[model samples]
Target chain A: MSTAVLAAPFQAVFDANSQEFSLAGVIRPRSVDEIAYSITEFRRAIDEARGVLYINVKRLAQMNNTAFHAFSRVVLDACRTRSDIRFVVVTSSVVGWTERMFHHLGKIEPQITVEVYDSKFYPGQSFVEDTSFIPILRAQTKMTWRHERTILPRHGMRPGIAMADICCGIGDFAVLAQKEFQPARIVALDHSKPSLAYARKVAAEFGVTGIEYTYGDASEMLLEDNQFDFVTCRHSLQVFNQPELLLKELYRIVKPGGRVYITNEKNSHCLGEPRAQSIQWTYNELARLLSHFEMDVELGPKSRRYLADAGFDDILVESFMITNLDGDPQDFADVIAGWEKMFAAMAARHGEAPKFIDRFRQGFRDHIFAALHPKGYAGWPIWAASGRKPL
Target chain B: MNAAQRQPAEAKFEPLLQFEMEMGTFLSDWHHCDQLSNFMARMISHNRTDPVRHSNFFSSALNELLEVSFRGGSPEGRIGCSVFRQGPKERVRLSFPCSPTQRRFFGEAVARTHKGDAYARYLDAISTDLAPSREIVLLDLAINFDAEIRLEEDDPPSISIIVDLPLEGIVS
Candidate 1:
């Protein structure tokens, strides 16, 4: 009866009446002890999830506040009670929380693993993460039915085939592959030993059987020559200094009649002669390299090029905008603020060049974050194109 | 396996021999190891501690880390620690097999003379290299300190004893 002392200010946000909401943003803690306490609360939230919630955190060391400890414990408790609670927490800048979360989840839901993302998109949106990143990225990532709804529309997973994922960062795509079609053999390979080790442990815990998490430079593993079927790469084509070597590696590894899929993010707003030339150097060069792989290449728009370039048949590109601003000036201003800081960061890094900076600013104005708030500019257009490696 | 090649008996580098037997390998390149980080270089040393007849209360606790670092990873990696002493702090190094462990794992350097200077003599004669690995990974033990955990090597084994946390014996 006298539980007012137990009540917290953030507890007000956990309206029992509100069916479900995403905890997509950052909540910094004040102390390390507080960090321990918050983990307990998030556990409660996962246990009692009226619906699935996405936690927006970067790393564990960054999480030191007492309030954050209470918050995390609530979320975790909620995950335990609810069956649909898919703990899709991104672990990059946050290590301690991830460590604790992994320790607990590794013991409990080892079968139902956590999905880790590189967080390449929304690089400068940490402040907005509080109310936005979790939900928007979930809808964007399609934790609910993202794979069945989007990827299924393009590349149909028939059942019983080894799906090779090159540069498998923290096992996101592999988790998706296991959940949906239950691919017979999933060869997930990455260069990072720690990443591979964690992925191996997660895969083992999550009961992702028949999936082998291996360590090697995808383009240069010292294994068999042509040893995979349906090789796939996502959002990592641009990072490699030598895209042609990777493409050649793909050509050599992918079986006859097997397909190769590659995806690279192309910023719609960032373009001009000099800027276009840079994109040409990075993004365009990969496409140019893909053209050399004996298979017929079909380059779809930015969103759909990965599956398409692999020579998948019937390639289609669909563009979706993240525009969901509810007339709240501050909210929209936050989105606008998010964009301003974003462009400022880019401008600072590259310099105040017209085509690169101005064009991107206009795109931000026309379609990326604030102006496209209605569609959630969470994405300008998500590319999806299917190409079949000629059987 | 040759007793003649081991520590305390070998007189030439006898101190260094006694040091190596206790500390395992001398990480000459310990400073370059990736397991630990830069800031830790100033703190924890990997040499042997001084032989001041530590009470059974302390030696019993100090032995846990001795077996783990050496036997936990590989046989070649297995290390047994030699104890040392100062007023509040102690140092122990994991010297290589066949090398004596006069090197300091903790406390201060050994001094050349001790006329009436015990601490200075301890620092000069006992301690080995101070500036080793700069890396300080929480999971690393090649250089950085490890809590002494007494356990049988059984998978996620069970801990039978715990080393005295400096806090317990320090304040009281």
Candidate 2:
């Protein structure tokens, strides 16, 4: 059962399925009387819920002491009466005071606990946020930028337009876009604090200004709707379990007639001429390995379908190959070498057979060998897709 | 060198933003507290490490102070708010019209917030059946934010409540 109560600028909802009593919008009522209906609904939710009752205040933007006191009263009463049930107050780090305020309640009542909702939003986040993997991420961006600089213009990227780069890991692309296109505004957002810290350091060291690097979950971004002329999320969807949720946010943030651009890889299609058989075998296993971790490494060709399903129109899709020929062969080899170190560890952690891990390790080594070979051609394919929000 | 001369120079605080309105106009609507804080937070938080998170926290803290001012201040006079920044610390000074009784109330409330057991006292204050005290909000800012709060009563009829919030790296 679900019940909703509106108290002017704020609304409260009790969802039985999630056992969550959620409050959103401004709740700065002068007195407790103003939110009596919400309180009634909240009490009913407490009565209905079993096990853990979640008081979700992630979106309660502005709440006064009166409102807090009222809610705290009900929560304290409930804890005292209902010995069978425990309460978990779900707070958002985005809303800074919520965790602190609720933590006071948790301290007062042992049955009550506080959890920051966005702290564990992405499952694959830990793997990608490893600082050791940062160099490879930079190398990947350096190679991909060569193709994207040309591809972006074809997909409606131009000078003096407002743009957002969602899942902008370490923010290299935002800096590149700032220099090459001079977008009027660029908001580059990522979920990782370490990555954003590194991004800020790099931007400061390079004296690159104007890109607002922010921390955010891509699927549930805090960005305003229809604000960006162009939004780009590159090489990120394949790593997420739910690419569509992220694409939905991208579509919502882009202005009508503005485009949402994305890039993803079909890891199984990674090619090298010198060690074609070994490289192909390892690449195929790499796809399966990523799948075991709930990531879709083969999401590149499916980009068009994802965009179309997300209510986008005038879809455009293209593929590009990043070859050893694109830059110094050493850089290409380094990327593969980095991937080998990262993926081999992941495979081992997943408890893959030692033989299977060895083969997987061999493939990356062969790919690197192909990149460094005097006459060899090594290729990594990426699909670039864009769709316009209907005007 | 004199003892004062031997001390390090105080960090300079850069002016960030300031807003002023007639006390009557501010008190006319309850929503003004929310509107002012949200608007000011958005305006100043664009350059923060996490703009959204910073804005949310700044707005929450500022709204509490605004609410306290709204409820306690006299109806006729000018109300002004000025914000200043020194590194990660942000200073908010709110000046509002106050009678002697209101000033005493605010003064005592702010003084109580400086106590070591203020957090425990705050929990007790809110948990009781008695009417909530204005000090609850101040204690919240003092304990939760580790804010430095002080009162300025040099000017008659109008008093300034200054709070310094070390906000950066604290939100996350």
Candidate 3:
């Protein structure tokens, strides 16, 4: 017989059939005694479970340091001793720091699995994370001609064209295009509220008007068919699980005579060579690390084929190399910091390996000392492909 | 003689207690460094309920060293920490590579502080009100460079920070 109890800070339910235990509530336990009770109760429930010990921490909010440490200790201890039962933590997306704490606990006991349900992609509709402070720093740095040329003026952007920038984080390209081309109407679409908020603030700061920022899934954007004269999604397509579906959406949204363009990092040429040295991990190494953790991001080269398959005529794919050996120290710092944030976020999202955590810590130091070496150099590759919709 | 056999006798300190951890040297990468600070506090306290008199002092000192290293402008770097009670004293030592700018800034910060304050103002620039415990007392901070002791150092030479932690009834 399973029991349900009011564990003060937690309302734990015992699922007898599935052999699972779940905790949810405004988890703000007052004293060490309460924290101990919570852990002990959860442990007792876990000992009873036969199969997967699903400890759903999805609804836990306001967990102080003591509560978190206490609860994580139980989970870690259970993972260490119990072979008959598999311990799983169903985490919430509200707090990223909790993910880090669990990441550390999981590292201590690498056997535990932390399942975070934050996938926001389907067919061609999805959201990509661009919350790192590094992109703002990149925007502060001057734009390169090679990257700009690939997306801009190639499809003959005129003032009268209606443009839509899909998955536009901070709308840097959109803002730039708005200034240079003076497009009649530019609608920037992105799914992340925080990113869109930042993009809006930046656009407003630039005093650049006539560009509308709409928030929604890219696959099912609230846009009418054949409405936009030109559509562009940069540094985002690769992040989509179904790049082809987003392309199809792009094809459907663009006018008959209009064009659609999208680009992503080719893992090999994505960031210049210094990126590897800065982090002390080569592209191959990073790819392996990402795969080992199951991050499922689109870093591999896949845009060209998808664009062609989406039925665009006169498709053009181009590769651009940005060599920044002569860039400022601050620029290098910003770039490295950006990559560091991105890597940590990725690792946190896909359960950090207990062994790799130590190496990852050392890698940062190695990257720093290597970056500061007198002969330091940095560069990376970006791939962009554009095609016109059938008239 | 074989390399191992040829080596002279090495004096080793018998550690009463010891712990090891690694951290990034840059502070601009806030989350990385913040987690590192917490790790230091956790390790120093050994997650024990016993009051660690000068836990904040250790955190503040470590934060200062990390911030000083970041001033050198290297986007990449790491610091290795070894905390142990050796011989008659307990100490936490951090070692990492440093750039010319980092060395200069760190030296300046140390120099600018009043002798009595022990660079508290300089350290305070990066952190504030660490709320150190009453049991903790300021001790000597030693800085060492790998090459400066023997020959001309590399452009960005390696450096080390040794902070003595005087704990009553806890020392060897």
Candidate 4:
């Protein structure tokens, strides 16, 4: 529970359970006197706090020097007087300035520390953000596009609608959607700077326009509510430890009556010919490997349940298989090769025994061999789901 | 060199957006600082690689400059802002009415911000018993945004504060 103090253009809430005092909205008073009540309330909360006191300014969109100076005084004074409690100032990278401003405060007092909220939001971010994985991401998109292009229209995707592609790694999907759907606007957002940079470069090289590539944390995005007619977070939810948080954000951004689309993979269901048993064992182990890292590689079939729980009507969910014959068998083989490099490295880093690693490596090599063989067949399954926000 | 002397060649920057209003109208409400910065940031940031992140940083830096101008400028003449872009660098020129005293204050504050120890001086300024000075805010833009700030006073009773921000490069 928390106590709320409402101030014009801003509000302060103190959660007694967490000892966090959160300040949100615009707090740009002309002078300190204008916000004396808030300042006093802030001081009171600090006084009554114990152990650690959190000053959360993650949602503060605007603040002036006057407000900063005033709040800094209270915080500084509290630090000097209270030796038992540590002061932590929580900021967001989305706001851009809060971290720098509060970092100065941290320098002034050793007891004060600044924490950027979204820094640790994604546990599996490092694995996918590797630039070496770019080629495989492109190939995977090429394989999925054959199915999604037809499936998207049935899920309410139409030309001239405003759309957002959350977690748009390297942004190939946005570029393809722009050509096919002609969205009035496209905001392709991702947390990886390198990926976004590559995406922008690719868009520029192709002379693609109208897609606004942006950097953001998907779970705690700064995007305003109800902004887009269609919001798609593709092959992303499975990578997060908390898929519900991502689903909540997707639900928040889509307009009323608009739809939220998502796609994920069930690694354990991936199948190949001839060496089918080895492939099944390896994929089951792959799911466990990802689970150990707080990721859900088996979230494909669970998409419908996730969307329904997120409060959407007219739920639609379907599955598609990307076989070696989708377009070119080489593309399918190349994707497995990339996955082998990434997952094998990850398993090694997790300290798996060399014998287990060898067997794991063999499964991928066999899968790739099957993908490239003349009489062999290999398939990867994906689930595409969407739900409409209630009107 | 002074702001006027250090001004980049006009042809190098392409102007993106500009807004003008009477200083009296602008200073009448403190909210204008937030509103104008946010509006301008959104309008200019769409074409950038990461529009949302760029706009957040741009708005924060622009809001500080506007707040400083609101506090230090004379409320009698027009206040105009023009934004320009050159590659990753974005430039904002704020021209407003000022008294001779206000001009000296901004001139010295901007100069102080360019000093090597501006971050330390900013910390000292904010921690003092007195109210936060305009220098503290200016140093914020200079230090945090890695901005190049200058004051141009060629027009009498009116001065232009020019801030060149590498907004895209800074955010990441």
Candidate 5:
């Protein structure tokens, strides 16, 4: 929810260039000016965190040392000027050569805070994994951007607690959770063998032993009730056949003071009529489910109202927008148009994804082109909702 | 175990030798820009191992892979690299990347390096021992950097390079 809150003022509300499906939540900004406004709002939000920064160091190789050291000077200045600027080196690597070099490079800039925010791609993935564009447009994504995502990070996560990532695909959240909280125990839950295998390789490579890998249906894991300090459900919740039952399960495992977190497609349409009805139904059931059990829930963008109805007193919502758009939209569109195709191509011997994504390619382009003339493609929805289970 | 002893039996090492895969179109781009000044200040010892993959004169098994990348528009191949006991498990972390290459170079400098257990086999063996716990971070950077290289429908997305520095840096 913090992300939504932090990014809403900064996130582009609509896009004019889109020509694909323009469902409500997927609405696009009619002009670049609208997006520019959102980007400014985002920058202001980022600036709110004293001593925090948003660095654009994509081409590390070509980046000049003068500019490199110049940024370090600002970081150092933040440390010198602000007492809370005690953090240092937000690196993506455990001890990446980049971080190592930064350590030596910034040695001249004393009082500098550095933190490495590396892409902890679950267990077996890399920060620089697949970047082919075709599959990007093929994803069946429906995440939304909400206005109240800033409550938590501003509040900051509860320190010294463990995190449990249910259905931890490729261990992305597991790595992020470890980075965010430095949680003593990061229990990664998943069922697929290959996914589990991939997760295992990642956990090992990044030396994230703090995480314990568990393979199984997360809803059925033999974990203790109220065992987790924080529970996060990423893109996995919407796919559940029984979302309400799972919410109850999530509520049950979170300790009284702990938080239950869920994020979903952030499109505005997801918040609309019948589809919203399904969401409302989930929330309503959560309310009924919790009242019977004497538990309170929080409803962020990801939650159903039933959570608030179920007696969650303090609720929060937010958004996180990473301005990285290098992935292939066609690939993404194909994944959404047809998931099985990518699955088959993944195990293909050669670059055989084209075969599976072939037919959908024209449709994907046609859809985007279609959206552009009409209004724009559907805006992927991403909603985040969280609430505390009262102690 | 010593390098010779650690060597996987032929059956075991066969799979290791045939290991390889390239990502996206980075290889073709990298090949074209191979002479571009190395980015990081440190000298990275990156060597494009033989056959460029499974196809080189080294083996017939690669026959399947060669038909793929050359004919197929995708990046694909199976090349092999390995790890083994170059140091005690504790000290192994530090010596890991270097020791294996040294073990290969130490046995024989050039020409015959890929010959037998002394060189090729040793490289594969070392990769096995270094059960390094890997970590991956999936970043959905909103902009496609490759758009700078290749674009489909429109102009590539431009990354706004904003360098935030307080105005006081100039006055001081």
Candidate 6:
């Protein structure tokens, strides 16, 4: 027996014949309190449903920060408790909104499937779709600073200590630091709202407080001078268009004697062969393509130099290697899929000869996977760099 | 001998190692636990004077068991642990508060030990390649509920998992 589920902001109708529950309703909450209340109620209703629950966000309109966080929290909470619920967000041409929602929510629990459709669906109605994205950005959310095994101030999350995490993707480092380091307060700055939202939501999920999520270009971070006791950036250092400027920004914000820590990929040295073997040839070709595309590339060994140029002292750089051979199989698959997605996006922007491109792409993927297999090893070098401002 | 002589000589196990820590719910991430376990294993290997076989064995076992225990409870639940080595035996005691769901999940895992091959395989793996003279390994698990307290109490009942390891290579 199935019963019709009723909740504010959601109306779930159960079909006894098909043994399915469809959730759909207008979710135009007027206030933040309303958003929170409605989301909590929605979760309860969905949880109480007898059959499989399929939520439709297509009818949801007028999404604000309050609404977005509420929606994301409900999905995350559902994922934590049960894996059966399916939440779908439909979009038309502008998929960024839907993508951003899934990007942040999916990071916390990558196992939860979020189905997306491009078709138009009605308000106050529900539908079922089994389609979901590959979740390429899932790995970023799972990144943690605790694994670095480097020497930094692991203590002192007191009320007096201040920390800043520049380009803090989804705020993992900042959150982990705040929880473990006992910092009085921390500011997580990122240019992407979706990433920041996700970070804030995670902070809430972990019950972490005393941290501020700021949305702004990290290179031009508007934090006060000498305002922080610690400043750090992780894998995002390599992605910055102007790393020198970002370093200066890091230097500018740190109080005298405060530390700056960073770890980023050594792109060229990643998964390279010692000789001109077929694997090495594939890596070289990829590098050649990247260079031809005029992408900004950073030298891993020059991290210390960049920090010194930005007016920091006592700089140290150490190399760390990560390989799929020692990692989870699922993560290995994600890495391969991520590479394919990146190449496909690049090809869309920068067209190449179809036949040559397909052959090269296939060869490149095959070589990378073969190297990453358990019998083989594909390792990448990361530079862990740290510096301190003059006292 | 006086009073000491009046009683029979109680068999005492010599202490080889001891460590204790309160791990908060933040360690729900299996990777963090894995890294910590690996680091601890390396530290142990560096400290031990005698040659030891299967150096990473204890760490890997701890990692797997920690994952199992973590999954058995809520992510935000805290765990208090004490690990020690006595004579040729190594023992670990983990205590954590559990919800009803967690309590059931834990009970299921403990019960599955009799019928399933995974738990048996893990026990076998841990027992292989011991130091030299050590004997059998033992696992003791218990879930205790507060009898006198009302259901409204904020503090829930606790579940403890203890594993004892006895292996050969003699020197502590």
On TM-score, the leading prediction is 2
Candidate 6 structure quality by residue, lDDT tens digits, A1-391: 0011111244444444443334333233334465455556666656675435445443232133334445555655666677665544333222223333344344456544455443322210111111122143445334223245333543212335778777666667676666556777677775554666676677778887666676445554434457777787776555544678678878877878888887766565655232225545545555555544443334567788888888888887877665555456456456655665565445544676776567546644664566555566665567778888999
Deviation in Å, model 4, residue A49 alpha carbon: 3.6
Q: Which residue pairs in candidate 6 collide?
A: A157-A182, A157-A183, B131-B168, B131-B169, B132-B168, B132-B169, B133-B168, B134-B167, B134-B168
Q: What residue runs in model 1 are displaced by over 4 Å at the alpha carbon?
A: A1-140, A143-150, A153-156, A192-210, A269-347, A353-379, B1-172
Query: Which ranges of candidate 4 are over 4 A from the true structure?
Result: A1-11, A24-26, A31-41, A93-95, A117-120, B1-11, B73-75, B98-101, B115-117, B154-157
**Once model 5 is optimally superposed onto the true structure by TM-score, how far is the C-alpha of residue A306 displaced, in angstroms?**
4.5
lDDT of each: 0.38, 0.87, 0.53, 0.88, 0.35, 0.50
Please report the candidate that would top lDDT against the real structure: 4
> Candidate 3 at residue A54, lDDT?
77
Which has the greatest DockQ? 4
**Tens-digit lDDT track of model 1 for A1-391:** 1121112112222223443322322233223353454455555445555444555433222221223324434444444656564655444311223433333332344323454444333222232223323233223333323433455435545467767777775665677777777767677766554555555566668866555565445444422334556677654555454455566666556665666665543443222222234322322322332333221122225424444444445444443332233233234334434544543454545444556455444433433333334433222223443345555
Instruction: Please give the lDDT score for candidate 4.
Output: 0.88
Give candidate 5's fnat, 2 decimals. 0.00
- For model 2, the stretches where C-alpha displacement exceeds 4 angstroms are A1-11, A59-61, A117-119, B1-11, B129-132
Better of 1 and 5 by lDDT: 1
lDDT by residue (B36-131, candidate 6, tens digit) is: 444444344332321112123344344444544444545455665444555545555556666787666555545444443633443342233221
lDDT (0-100) at residue B47 of candidate 4? 85
Place model 2 in a CAPRI quality band. acceptable
Encode model 2's per-residue lDDT on A1-391: one tens digit a residue: 0011122357799999999999976788888888899999999999999999999887676677888899899989888999999999988776667778889898788999999988776766779878888999999999999999999999989999999999898999999989999999899988888999999999999998778888777876656567789999998999998998899889878999999999999999999989899999999999988898889999999999999999999999999999999989999999999999988988988899999999899999999999889999999999999999999
Give the residue spans of candidate 5 off by over 4 A.
A1-156, A266-302, A309-311, A319-363, A366-378, B1-172
Q: After best superposition, candidate 3 residue A361: deviation in angstroms? A: 5.9
